[model samples]
Target chain A: MSNNLTIALDIMGGDYGPRSSLPAAVEAVNLIDHLTLILCGNERQIRCELKKLDALTHPRILIEHCSEVVNNDDLPSSALRNKKDSSMRISLDLVKSGRAQACVTAGNTGALLAMAHYVLKMLPGVKRPALISTVPTQTPKPVYLLDLGANVTCDSEVLFQFAVMGAVVAEQAQNIDSAKVSLLNMGAEEIKGHESIKEAAKLLQCSEHINYIGYSEGNDIFSGKADVIVCDGFTGNVALKTCEGIAKLIVHKLTKALNKSLFNKFLALLLFPVLKKLYKRVNPDQYNGASLVGLRGIVVKSHGNASKKAFLAAIEEAVREVERQLPEKIRYKFEEIINKNA
Target chain B: MSNNLTIALDIMGGDYGPRSSLPAAVEAVNLIDHLTLILCGNERQIRCELKKLDALTHPRILIEHCSEVVNNDDLPSSALRNKKDSSMRISLDLVKSGRAQACVTAGNTGALLAMAHYVLKMLPGVKRPALISTVPTQTPKPVYLLDLGANVTCDSEVLFQFAVMGAVVAEQAQNIDSAKVSLLNMGAEEIKGHESIKEAAKLLQCSEHINYIGYSEGNDIFSGKADVIVCDGFTGNVALKTCEGIAKLIVHKLTKALNKSLFNKFLALLLFPVLKKLYKRVNPDQYNGASLVGLRGIVVKSHGNASKKAFLAAIEEAVREVERQLPEKIRYKFEEIINKNA
Candidate 1:
């Protein structure tokens, strides 16, 4: 296995644990070349699952034993403090040392964030790590939204940094140059929102590091107006969840309306092919993972309820992130900006 | 025309102004029995638009002269101070002087809110007004979400009152009794968010005026889990707009994806019927208006870019609000709760 191709995976994380994680790991290993997986969890359970896939008994697959499991209900700090032998902690340690290039988990998000912060540490010039997700907008390319439920209380500097990091990811990972960044506000005016957003607008406007495209209201997020949308965690989290909720509602309503009468049911039958295509486009499960940005290494967080498909997507995302060397690119960008300013 | 059915409409409001307002007024007068409309704006412009409508000569219509107009860019306080002859100011005056049962406008939202607060005054228990809207969810019925874009900063008491008002509108106006009221939070847990939300949860937990259904996150807004979803104006506004943005993105993506190739183009032709039905189901123009709740009477706020169709929907919503006597029902509900506590 290549030295730069190792991933530390928390096998005892997520709702279904080995049932979902094992299949995803196998799929990822099969699809990607020259990759090694350092699995951290209950050794016996993992081996049993690996035994189910006879071909997985390769030199590239290594198991790191960890007895304790970080429960979903456990407080983040408590897991970090008490569960020293937990799978999440052991996987993070792999990334901390030279054993792994990145980490992937569908475990307790708070615990994962805290452990990554305590272990890998933030990159230089990065104040706090932000969670970034690619939202499929109407544009040809997806839009990147950052600080999604990461830091609820953020200042202008934090948001400004988020924009810089978001722009870097969009350019390197998404292969889009000159990424447009917009600050999420109540309105499209310079004087909207509370003190934090207003202050962020001013700082972003002055920063030569990013292509700050002034203010954008929530409606502009998916309107193809900006490539990178930055906001405080509270607002970003609410906005993201609201969009998901509404999409689900719209699909539900369409289905119900189509099934109301015999004539409508016949129409539904005729339109089943198209309706199925539309459903596939809007399903949340297709986009069920987020990446923790501004860290020294890649850390992809999958949904706790993620199935094998979702886990595979997360693993694929981690692979792309490592291949792109996103962290190093961000560091280089920041240093150039700092040197220019100095 | 019934003496109690007079509605003062801002004829010089909105981007289209009397062009959209006059036709909407005629439609309302024709649709609702015993309804009268007092058109407040420049008499000449009102007359010009009125002449376009053959039904403008009906006895139910009256024009009140107001020379000045509140431009969209005017500051709220400055507009109030400088334009005494503005349609917004004159309409509010009609409400204050008991000449009209309600005032509807598509003018500057800030100026309308200020005039609404200044002239109509808040109910005894409400600290500020809430902009409430009915969002059609996946369920057969529409859900009511309050503080859409009104009060940005809200305390526990204010949120509690918004919940009560939202529930009243859902039950009386929308005819959904036993309405489930939910406080929007980051998580469903009791200890989530800042102190205000925690306190609001406690108040809702003990509230008897509405059916409090515990805490709901942003993801639950479109799940039909709650009939009335309440949050501070800042979050509510962001949530509403984000939903709109995502809906537009979905339609845009579908159209683009369907036109990519010959086979897809054929598939698009096959699916056009169902897609058109779904598009109409989620169009914002069909639901383009919001009600300014906690007022002495119904005050509907239509979008500035509202076309004739949107204006027609707003007039229908106002007619329903008047027929339901939403203000009196809210008054009774609040008074009952206050008296019980006292």
Candidate 2:
């Protein structure tokens, strides 16, 4: 690990713009001793935020101005084609040009991916990049779920590629040895699911590269079962949001229930420590970083409505991925598979 | 409504055989004023269970002996082909022969659907039967989620049919008149999702029969934003199981957290009442019955491992559907569409 670990922050993206990103970047910089930050956005806004922390002239902190910001509603293709001077594009340029080891953005995810793909391009032998995120489980660590929302529509080949890419992340980034890979399906049975998934399953089963486990139903995602679960982006996104919705619904119900009685209020007070711990473990903020896997360089997308803490978590993931040389490992893995096929 | 609304119970089905079904049947009989039950299964086992409940001589309760039982391992085609003497088949026969208005089973869902379809056949214009279940939401009533695990794969036309069927059920059964219908997709935007979903979205949008709201991600399932959600069985099944998994994980984590310390234990005691309500509300058993929709006859599948209370819920759903003439409503809706096309 080098002492010159630099991660770029897209300070002008996300709902809160610089408000959340600036504080979160500072938090990450403070948390990681060897880290330096390249804040790419409007110079005046970045300077004002830095002055709030009284680190305007810090040696490690560098602010690069971009003329425009990529708003959440901006079309990905339009942003890629038109918003060349936007903070999102400029920050990604830092990653593409090797000026920063990694880039983190709490911005429009589609725009970030679109720009990153156009700028950084995919690694050799990789068909497409998948959105990779760590979903919570009963295990000491989280399971890696990929193709969360990047490619809404996918075929068997794309799904197969996701398995290969996800396997690498599960093994290298998550550090799961002999990582068990499973195709996310409607049922665990071999006969279940659609044609593309069935074909993808056959491909995975025959491949010796991955420890291809059998099909995993949605429930299996949080069961602490498979190390990596792959699905077409559509199903994966629905499943991810489904988990969030249920958690939100449960928490909402619990809140309403807890507010009903004095005894319930007392119980909540007594249970605050454990409840807080449980909530923290399941919090979306705790698992906010979603890596743009299959990209040539490290780029992590923070939740659009992320708070400062959540954005900081995304920065942490980017730093970790950069330190591990995630792209290098994925490229090596992809080339290895290609050579084997040849 | 006459006092002759009879329902058939597949007593030999499910894990508990006659244990859960007999009690559930009795509970349904007691709960509904104009209800009778034909307990169809092995004569000796039915008698033993009936004796246990002291229901042997009840005039409204009739026993119809079945020679064979359909095991979960039995293939759907084999169960339909050879298991004619099975309790599941015999129960469907009761519905077909006009001895019962509905059939209830806590058995292999595939076997039940097969036998029910073989004996009853599909309603005109309905291509395939979809499994429908009401998942709890923030709304006063739960939202109807369909294709829980019926059709493994679905085409655009089939998906459109699901929307129609779901809309009818939402209107007549769930009583959401002019139900807001939505296609389950990864993204809400029109350009997002796969070919079939995009096609289905067009069909839904163009059709005036359903109050077709656009695409709904998994979160919207519980947000009470739409009354009915329709998707292919694979995605729907994964989404449904994903909800179950998250709920289980949260409960498991909460249980572990609650037992961590003396303070937590004390809090658990004070929060017992509210926690109990929350648990009851979220329990899978509370949502036991899932209707086998798009079929000509009303059939309800209970969770195979359902408790007496859970099985009772399934029976209650069947009773409600039979009383409301759900099949007739769906048939009329289907025919109306067919006539409009013609």
Candidate 3:
């Protein structure tokens, strides 16, 4: 009801702290009109950065002082329990209390997920929340992959719900109507994977809510065969990480190959522009943020190593979620499906 | 004994006809010393291709006539039952009857696996046969990832044995004296994955036959953190496919960027050699074959679309299996582990 999109950001999260978060927040504020930010962290550090920004002051940027920090090595549950005034916890509380429309954090993923589940609660009929991310595909647009690393072990029902939720996100966020949903399987065959996936396939096949394309092999993910690829968190997590590792390896090898000799080095100099574009296309930071779906309030989890660009993108993603009213739409769809089936 | 390292190949298995298989067999024979081949397929087509080869008269090459071909579309069970005189069945029988040291197939992977399991039998103490494939790591050496697409659902005991078998293969093939084995998990923590991986991890941690390296994430697979990565076939298949898909996407994107403008095209021409070398390094054909570990007889399965190079590599892999006595070694190791634990 505030008439403006306000995002509560955990300024103390990620590797670079307020130095990255403040710049990212400022960049996001400048990019989006009618936007406000509540930067939650130690007030002194935020104020120091804010002083450096000579832009005309607007009431849009506010600071909520938080006294504690959650280090990466801290046990997620212990951190959530012990650090009551931690920046991440405070940011989530802001969304939960309706002080902010959405929450953005690059803190401990486990802690963020736990706090979100405890505070915002799952949507009706949603058993658990799924962390969904997008990877730029060879298609004309990006493909959204879900359950990236949220719940490692899930049943058929969870997978079916993930498929539905992923399709909804793709339809609203990526502007892809009738998003094709495919289950990630070992092979394209009907009888190629674990029991849960087979059961999920049966459910998805019967559902009219989605454009349930049949099974897709891993190679088909980036082939643009489907707009949304759904799987349990374990496999999805591994797939995402594997893609990242391979990208890094490719870049490292290319750099080494380029520097092997004088001719190659000169070629590298000429190819630097195109190679840089290609590298940016595959960089995880450019696509470093994911949304924790199935919760009552919007929560965006940025990568732990996220830089200014990635953090800002995460804030923009949160703004998009608020603008789209993703939670309300999700609720309406789930209700429609459940009532229709009933 | 024939005293020849002869292999019987199923010429009718893969997507292409004897066009690919026959040439591949000829190429394999040229590389392996004192090696012979029994090309099993329709009599007329085999003879026609054989006549095209200048070395057909050499004592090393022979042809086994098979009346029927196993179609990829045929059901695995039905193919095994009705295709009695099929090339795939006949080739397996050649290995079983001691007429050939091993059998190589690029046919229907399911039917090939079924035939190998039904005919050659499992190594003593191996409850299930695992399809172990080599993945080229960022390092100069390759990492052996097992249960790539074999058993979709496996118990803890089967995974524990897979780790041992994979370790042995990596040691023998990569010439690594101490093979480091790691269980692929969603995270590096102990409680990160399902119950099966957790139990498997406990068994592997105390395993005496292999160098157990605890847990590894998907990124660790390419970092050379472990020489052998063990997982259920479901996860392994997806992970491997994801890597393939991502690599292809990177290459595809690079191709696009390089062709965008004249200057980029010039750079591409200058860097063509290095780019080609990098492409060759990541090509699926370079790591094309999989070994059916835990089987009593040596069986190597190649990609259905394998070119002459991949087929030749499959033949070489079978030769290595014979030289290393992989099956016997696996049986001994499994028996030792079972006995000690019991």
Candidate 4:
């Protein structure tokens, strides 16, 4: 709604760093008319990249020089304590200070998560922040899966909170009216999974705000059966990464099969575009942004080895979340649940 | 390597009951010369189905004539307690009584797991039985993934035991020596995953028998980086089912794409066989037998909705395990480790 929608970018993050982020920044500004990007990284490098892209003089792009960079191998605690001036931290800080409405990073996930949690903090009545991402399903719409390596182990209440947050995300981000949510379990049976998951299901069932669908198996993740699927970070991470692995395996298998014969080679050429489109649809990296929800402010995480297009997608996701006022909606939903309980 | 190898089949199991199992049994007996199958189900039904295939009077086929059947919705505890005469339990009983070298079933996983554990019991030094299956990887050889909904939660010791068992299966079943074993985690980093996984990594590293390849993320499951990958049942189940789901989605997506236009439809006809082959290779149901290892006798659990070919595949898997003496190998490995620790 605002004319000046500022988002911060951690240009010093990811494997390629400025090589990907700078171009993504330029593309993002060109794509979104009302968007302003605060590039938080090395001043000299940012200017050089911007000048090469012919966006150096662009009024929408602002540079915030940061001296340190968080290495991929750096421990999250060490990154939090030592790398305050790092681009990842600075981008989060911009969000904290209201200089930016949201921040996007293709940085080390642990470092970015720690920095965002430290800088943005949690929303009222939220115990933890979850990494929620839209995964392609069998249906036309993608389903939301949450707690993707945020908190490895969660109790019933934490999972309940995640379900609420996921519902808000699916509803607002996708503009769906009453998003059906489900707990990711070992089986669809009510007696399945760990006690915590079963307890979370009971809690979700009682909540009138959430349209709590029954348990969803991993097979159900991409079946488009539920709008939002909630699980512990470990399970969610495994499921998401398994999706990545399977997509890669499929592409690999299909390529290998197509490369077998001369006639098949001819078929490959004719089918290349369709196959490429299919790969793009299924490839998790192409949909790179996984939002850190339940925080006071928005933070979108791009993949560590994200391409320029993927980084831009992350920026777009942050813009979407910012426009939707994600945190505020989550806060209001939580407040509603709390008041009802009281 | 016995001239007379007998295996029991739970003909009353699965959705189709005798429909699929009868054909699979006929196929298995025809495929393996030394194989003798004890059909455990309703005598009249088995005779009626086998007569259709002209296999009722086959010399190698014998009927056990169990009256009861385990329903899919039956609780594991109740099934184990009440369904003593059920075909699933009778198959396990045949193995326990040394009447059959191995047992194959396409029953309710929970019920089969419970009955198998109850009747066959665990091998000495084995903490728990795990469901291990081969999944197609990028490599020519498929990798073995274990704990597929067998044990919901596993501690360090249980995981360590699973590693030992998984290694035996990968090495013996695939005819590979010193199979590279990896613990499935959220990240390859030592610092990542839950504490149990990290501790399991340490235990695995200390073992001389196991070729312990540190951590493998979910994406590494089918990367062919490790020969055998182990995780707690919940994670393993999700990952395995996720593979099933992805394969279905890919098939669904490709079919929809092919159906789009006349030109695409023409191309689809040529590519149909290749895609079918790819689907068969990747489809978890095709490679349906998930062996319940760490038990005294071999028990291969086929998919509940297994086709005749898939059930035949399970029988073939059981034959392979019987030939290789999988349970004996696992027992010996555990003994070697225990003696070293002592």
Number of the top TM-score candidate:
4
Which regions of candidate 3 deviate over 4 angstroms? A1-3, A52-58, A283-286, B1-3
- For residue A194, give model 4's deviation from the true position in Å: 0.8
Misplaced by over 4 Å in model 1 are: A1-4, A260-277, A283-288, A335-342, B1-4, B174-178, B260-277, B283-288
* Alpha-carbon TM-score of each model against the true structure: 0.93, 0.96, 0.96, 0.99
Instruction: Put down candidate 4 lDDT per residue, B1-342, tens digits, no spaces.
Output: 457899999998998889999999999899889999999999998888888899878999999988799999999999989998999999999999999999999999999988888888899988899998888899998988989999999999999999899888888877778999999999877898889999999988887888998999989988999999999999999999888888888888888998899999999999999999888888774456688999999899989888899899999989988989888988898888889889
DockQ, in order, for the candidates? Answer: 0.57, 0.74, 0.74, 0.87
| Candidate 2 residue-wise lDDT, B70-89, digit = tens | 99778788888998888899
After superposition, the stretches of candidate 4 with alpha carbons farther than 4 Å from their true spots are none
Candidate 3 positional error at B113, Å: 1.5
Residues A207-273, model 2: lDDT tens digits: 8898888899888898888889998877888888887777777777887777778867766676667
List the candidate 2 regions with Cα displacement exceeding 4 Å: A283-286, B283-286
> Clashing residue pairs, candidate 3?
B13-B107
What order do you get sorting by DockQ, best first?
4, 3, 2, 1
For model 3 the local lDDT of residue B248 reads 81
Per-residue C-alpha lDDT of model 1 across residues A1-342, encoded as one tens digit per residue = 444499989988999898888888888888876788888999998898898887457777899999999999888788889998999998889888978888889898788888889888999988999988877766667788888877876898899889999999899866778899998887775555778888888887887778999888878887778899998877877887877677777777667767778876776675567556665455543355889988898898988877888888888888888888989988998888788888
State the lDDT of candidate 4 residue by residue for A1-342, as single tens digits. 566699999999999999999999999999898999999999999999899999999999999999999999999999999998999999999999999999999999998888888889999899999999988889999999999999889999999999999999999978889999999999989888999999999998988988999999988988999999999999999998888888888889989999999999999999998888788777765566699999999999998888999999999999988888999999999999999899
Candidate 3 docking classification: medium
Q: State the DockQ, from 0 to 1, for candidate 3.
A: 0.74
- Candidate 2, chain A: TM-score? 0.96
lDDT of each: 0.82, 0.83, 0.84, 0.91
Could you report the Cα RMSD, in angstroms, for every candidate shown? 2.6, 2.0, 2.2, 1.1
